[model samples]
Target: MSNRRDVWITGIGLVSSLGEGPEAHMQALSSGTAPVVDATGFAPYVVHPLAPISFDAQIPKKGDQRQMEPWQRIGTYAAGLALDSAGIKGNKDILGTTDMVVAAGGGERDQSVDGAILTEIESQPNPEIFLNEQLQSNLRPTLFLAQLSNLLAGNISIVHGVTGSSRTFMGEESSGTDAVRIGWSRIAAGTSEIALVGGAYNAERRDMLLLFALKRLAMHAPWAPVLAQPRGVPTGSAGAFLVLESPEHATARGAKPIAKLSGVWSERAQRNEPGAVEAVIEALINQARGDVTEGTAILSAASGAPEPTAAEVAVLARSGLPVRSITDRVGHGLEAQMPVALAIAALAVSQGSLFAPLEGEPLEKPFTETLSRAIVTGVGHWRGEGVALVERAD
Candidate 1:
């Protein structure tokens, strides 16, 4: 829309249970080995089928860890990987020459912890005396400060010394894509030369999964029994970042461009709007000149279940591009949704291939036929707010 300036992905950083590096992640996705495991890091939190992640013990000890929530760590760590991948080492001189942005969402605390706290309060002696008026109320301010969403952006900037234009969002699954939009805008507008854009989420809590199951939004695909739920958000943890810059800027600096940020389009779905989903699909195709008529493939956002997957299928059926689902293997990491999704999109663009979800044998259904140049769709339940998104192949 803004003269269509050329933008390229020069770097990518990912920290997921599947494996930290790009090649390793790609291998895991291809092999169908889901990094998701039952919650063990915080076993005291629950007993159920959870997507667990083995934390890197090598992470340095800092006072921030004492106060920062797990998601902040994920954000900082993920940002570091993207900077390392981009070859940007926090130099003021370098950042001064580029603009940057951080995209994220799910600032809401998973209410599942409230039940556990209430249980703990029950065991207190003279529970009424200690908990009646409100110990939690007194501690609310401290807890609120610890989980502020902007803290993630602040942590990332501190890690990488990115003193440039910054942007943050809270659109859950669409957060990363929206962040990319900001980065693309900065470079195209000549405000900055390069930008770091992505998302992160720390959802290892069992209550997070239980909450989604309550909403019937949890993974309920007939085949993904382990991840199935009747409602609420699926629990997941992931951090990823992408280095974006104008094609001319990257080439001038001799950066190996991974993929071009070609086109992006989104449409918000209304409550029970019959054609709301298709409306977003049409918007994407129209933006891409009626399906990038010459585009190669599509990267789908469906998270390996029937309802969301079926919704994506119908959208792609209209777009006329092959649709592929990455979540079947990546697991559902919410806010980290597009950061991981777009990062994989960059990889496939460079390799000239589209990746597919791993075979579940009993439950996995292949979307390979439709995922060649696919449309990635994500359905989120942060209270009736859902989104549809599409990204083009390089």
Candidate 2:
């Protein structure tokens, strides 16, 4: 551990319902502006819709933009922002070898095709055979390609010219945590000099809404702070990417270290057993909290699902660090949650201050001290628990 190289977060690209890029999010956080939520668009169910983004700013090729779904475009654009922030946007020398890890969900479904298949299958003599035939004939070939979880990475390669060893993870929240963990681990171990890591989510899709709704996991009431929500997750459309580099690599390139990624710890708990989530999260937090003195607060990515959120809340309360749930403003981004939380934590640490608390949450008290470190915690709605420590790059 003593020989491990320091991992620095040199650049960050974050887009959410709050806005695009770090500046917008910083402003939103500092000002304590109300979160933008659409209760009626998805009707009864509340969601944080993504603000308007001009895809041309990052993905210049109209053809490329047209071919990608919203999630891919979001990720590709965020990746470009990160490279640009790192001053390596068009620098093929660094990008060509920069490793890439993406956390993504399955591609968007073709609703029209799905509807037609369902409609015709009921009338067929053999519904099973008809369903199979419709699946093959009705779905477009490109649609299948779009559904590949790795397409987000592929699009980034095409548009941003990353051309690195690409890897994609598909589990929901765990995927995001693992992606960051691997990127940081590689940089720290000197296995890789630089890495691009993150994910994107499209919360406006009906299929995603239906998927959560069926499980009674979609919030159907007015928006509230994540911890205060009675039940369900208020999904958000977001894209977050971070440019992680070794201290030597960053200094050699003259890239300023926004913050230091000290450590990342990930775990999956057996939720069927009582107290398992709390136990796992407590252990991960203890591991991540290395030599910290003071000015440390917690940025929690607590998805508003009742049970896990409650467990996380209880554990955080015991830790006694001032806690702010990022989901209160950005909504629960599933795979993007961990990255978004890390990005915001880095931003806070670099600026030497923590953001204001939500109006309604008593647990998220005010913190006026100079912030030198931040702990980002993620307890997935269903499975997966993780904690990451970010410290000022002094």
Candidate 3:
């Protein structure tokens, strides 16, 4: 913590099933309507699909769109949105020095190619040889190129012109948590001035559903609020990115901060012992010096999986704060979950009001007064735990 500079959230870009931008999400939340969920398409699994968005608005060039995978496109577009929100989209001077940190996962799998391989391997006597040979002969270099986790940052640099230091973090929810954490840490420590940070997850794919289902983590037909019961995760398609800048830097540019990113802390606890996740959450909250006072809400990225979700809710019980399970509306976005929560928290703090109570979750109380502070927590389905605090800039 070098001199401890204030980290301001100057820009936020969030696209989820609820809709796009701050206004769309605020409207959906104020209405307290049941979120959009797709049950029949994935059959047994319920997923919050990405809302209809025109890629041309952000990714502009056809050449850029064609060269990327769905997740990469999603990330790139979100990154552009963040840059635009920061009021520095075309400023080559600032962009040349702006650092970026992205939380991302491996690219989406090509189901057709995967299907072909599986089908053909089923009949081959030497399946290993056939599989290896087929992979070597049929897999295009372009496939691997799309799978690069850093492509989100690369594409952002290409399309948005954020030509600065870049980093990509993997490992699902924790990765999202740490992306902002590192961004804040660097800016606060004076190691960097302005930075672009966040992630995107296109969970509307069969591969993503299959991966979650394998762990018995898919929510079926009767979709309910995340904390309504001990439920499985309903995957969501979303992309979220935020622009963080130091107080001095933002003020110099005449950029008004929406909220101040006060603190960020994350951890991974061993799940072999019961109550371990709860302990991790407590420690992380303590680290952030998170306030759980009245007029504050907990924007929990509870992923909706039983093990960690239960433990996390148990810990949050001590806070006695109004809680909102964001995934209930936006669904579970692995890499983008925590950052999106932070963005929503910033919006709530700035607007001075909490959203309507989450339906089906009786304990998720609604605060009628203006919102002042938000404590955002991320509990990974199986592993990491993180906590962050955002408050009104004023």
Using all chains and alpha carbons, the TM-scores for the candidates as numbered come to 0.78, 0.96, 0.95
Poorly placed runs, candidate 1 (over 4 Å): 32-61, 96-98, 106-117, 120-129, 132-138, 142-147, 220-234, 289-295, 303-309, 360-375, 379-394
Q: Alpha carbon lDDT of residue 369, candidate 3?
A: 73
Candidate 1, 1-394: lDDT as tens digits: 5576777778888876666758877776766554454444444221223224333431355665555567777777777777777777666776665555666654445354556557778788887866644545633443533337777777666656777766777756666656776776677676667888887876665546556665565543222422222222234577788888877777776787776666555445662766665565556545554434444455554543344444545665665555455554455666777677778767665665555534432223344332323334454433111222323323
lDDT of 2 at 220: 85
- Tens digits of per-residue lDDT for model 2 on 165-276? 8889988999999999999999999999999999999999889999899989899867878786548899999999999999889999888899999999998999999999
Tens-place lDDT per residue, model 3, 154-258, is 999999999989989998899999999999999999999999999999988998889888989999887887776758998899999999999899999999999
lDDT of each: 0.59, 0.91, 0.87
In TM-score terms, candidate 3 sits at 0.95
Residue pairs in candidate 2 whose N, alpha carbon or C atoms collide under 3 angstroms: none
